[model samples]
Every structure is written in C-alpha cells, then in structure tokens.
Target: MKSFEKELPENYDALKKKANYTSSWRDRLDAVTTLSAYQHEKVIDLLNNRMKNDTVFKVQTAAYKALVAFGENVEKPTPARFDVIKGPNKIFLRVKKSLPKDHTVEEFADKLKRMRLDVYDAFEGDKGDQFMTWLEERWAKL
Candidate 1:
C-alpha cells in the first residue's frame, strides 16, 4: 500500500478527481490531506462533502482519517469528537461514543470493525483489555 506521506500534492482539482474513484481511497485521502495542508477553503469543502456521502467503508474511513489529519486547516468546527491513536502499523480513531464497560471486548471490537477502523490484536486478552480501558476512559470524559 502507498503511504499518504509520499503521494499527496498541492493541486485541489486533481485531489477532487481522486476522491471520486472507488479503488484509490488511500491515495485520494492522501491527496486531500496534502491539499488541506494549504488551508484552502474550497479543498476542505470538497473533501467534507465527499466524506459525508461516500459509500465504501475504506473510502469513508480514509475520509474520516483525512479529516482528522487536516483538522487544523478546517474553518468550521464539527460536532463530533475525533481522536486518533497509532498502533504498531495502523492508525485508529475514536470518532464517536466509546464502548461501555458492560460490553465485552469482542463486542467493542466488533463495533470498531463495523466502523472500519483498523484494529489489531483484537482477540488477544491483554490487548483487548487495553482497548476497552481506552474506550472507558474516553467515555468517561465525554
């Protein structure tokens, strides 16, 4: 997989075109992120619109990731709280409400999977516990 760090450019038009494709979610997100770095209002609008309507999970996830990645450039504040956590090789987000303590780790993992967050070692006891604990803390703050 191509990393977003190397593929994005400054052109907003090209980035918009990339966002319309089905196969290049990561690439498109990279491009958008790069464009967002310039803090252009138009670029942010285009990316937000696409992200809200995107059908594919990967694309939506990428969109959300890009939103967080370029958050500093956004002019308007979003109602949703976005939190990002980086693991060994992937980045995950706490986009909405965190899991409850009553819920099993498997259940929480399932929820994350449903949201298409790249969760790792979800079945391992310690890791799962840590993830749940993380959610619990986040939930408490909410």
Candidate 2:
C-alpha cells in the first residue's frame, strides 16, 4: 500500500496571513482549523506559533488541538488570566463617560465597538453567545 501525505494547498499563503492576523482571534482560530487539513511542516510551524503566543486562550487551544491532531508533541497552553483587552476597567470607564446616564447596554456595546474594536472583538470572541450577557453584567457594575 502506498502512503499518501497531504500537500500544502495553494491557499497556504492566505491561510498563513489569517493565522498571523494579530487583530482578529476569529481569523487565527479559523486558520488553525483550516491548517489542520494539511500535514506539512509549514502548517505545523504556524500552529505551533499560535499555540505558544496567541493572546486569546481560544485561539491557542484551537492551535494546540490542531497540532495534537497532527500527532505533534505539545503541551496545552495555559488559559490566559487576562484577555487581549488591556485595562478593561479603564476602557469601560471611558465608554461609560461617553454615554448619557440613561444609555442602554446596547449603546455601550455600540460605543465600545466604535471606540476600541480590539477590545470588542476579544470579548465577542471569548464570550461568544454570552457576550451580551457579560456586557450587561459589566455595565450594571459600572
């Protein structure tokens, strides 16, 4: 029986770009899943990079899973104590100050999206469907 090894796809460069797009954890996580289809060293290295250094825990976990699926020896990355959003309390305060006292959480979320897309994206990715709930909880505290 002849053994078959997966070859790098023509879209490898595009996938690489997605994997390295520092601003979007969703892109990086999707890239890890997409890269898992190939059995090439380049893909392995890219997954390794994400596993070791992605600021988002979800992206890092996706990369670790991909590498494990590829039969690579890797330790699971620790869950991040903090999210990619630095000083979220400060950001929340800024957003609060920008809004009227009677502003809704929806308004706050919209303002956050407009003001700090990085923070918005991180929370959205991290919280998934619970993003709104989390936002409301935080807003209540503010």
Candidate 3:
C-alpha cells in the first residue's frame, strides 16, 4: 500500500471517467495512479468501486493500494458514488469527450492563432457563444 506522490491533473474527472471506462487497462491503471495522488474525499470512494468492480486485477490491486494510502479499509467501504457532476456542478466541466483529452484553452487559442481563425468576431458577427459552437463543431471532428 504505497502512497502515490505524483500530483493529480486538473482534468482529473475526465481521467477518472477514462480510468473506469477506457478499454485500455494501461490507461486505466495510469488514471488510477494519478487519482490516488489527489486523496480527494471522493477519490477513496472511486477507488473502492474500482477495487470491487474493475475487471482488471492490476487495477483492483492499485485501487487497494490507493485506499490503503488514504487510511481507508478495503472491506468496509461506505456506499457512495463519485458521480461528482451527474447533472452539473459549481465549477464547469469539459464534457466534450469527442475531443482530445489534453486539449486546453491555451492550445485552442494557439491553434486559432496559427490558423488565423478568430473566435472573436468570426461567426455571424457574434463573438462568444458562436465561438463555443464553432469550437465544439471542430472539436467533434478531432
């Protein structure tokens, strides 16, 4: 039950989704390891689910280690689901799963800059909402 020392990324919710649902166990294991680093209260709950229900043995073991790191007992987990935003939340989430996992506002801006695409004053003479729509449409193709 070694503690994870790495830091969790801001895209953690997405990564958690990736861990439990991705076909690639390597990615799932990576996601679990990253999530363990955070020790978020919900993280233990998620790890318990992973330990109990994951089809992959290594992932279950990883989750067990993570629970141990958090000083939680594996056999006595509380009934909880880590659906942090089943509807939505105080902080917005990027639920656009069709796009690349690591795409960011900075990269989006840089790409727009390189392509000379203007999110501002570019579509139907509307700036903000139109930009989001444009980005969504383009991101869907990625």
Best by lDDT: 2
**Model 1: lowest-lDDT 10 consecutive positions:** 119-128
Per-residue alpha-carbon lDDT of candidate 2 for residues 83-127, written as tens digits (9 for 90 to 100): 556679889989999999999999999999889877887788778
**Candidate 3 lDDT score relative to the true structure:** 0.57
> Which residues of candidate 2, in runs, are more than 4 Å off?
1-6
Measured with C-alpha atoms, the lDDT of residue 128 in candidate 2 is 82
Tens-place lDDT per residue, model 1, 76-118, is: 3332232222342232335234665566545655665565443
The true-versus-predicted C-alpha distance at residue 28 of model 1, in Å, is 2.4
Question: Model 3, 28-99: lDDT tens per residue?
Answer: 678888888877766777788887766455677788888887877666333225321133221123333323
Candidate 1 colliding pairs: none
Report lDDT (CA) for all predictions: 0.48, 0.85, 0.57
Alpha-carbon shift of residue 114 in model 2 (angstroms):
2.0
RMSD of model 3, in Å? Answer: 14.9
lDDT score of residue 41 within candidate 2: 93
The TM-score ranking, best first, is 2, 3, 1
Candidate structures ordered by lDDT, highest first: 2, 3, 1
TM-score of 3: 0.46
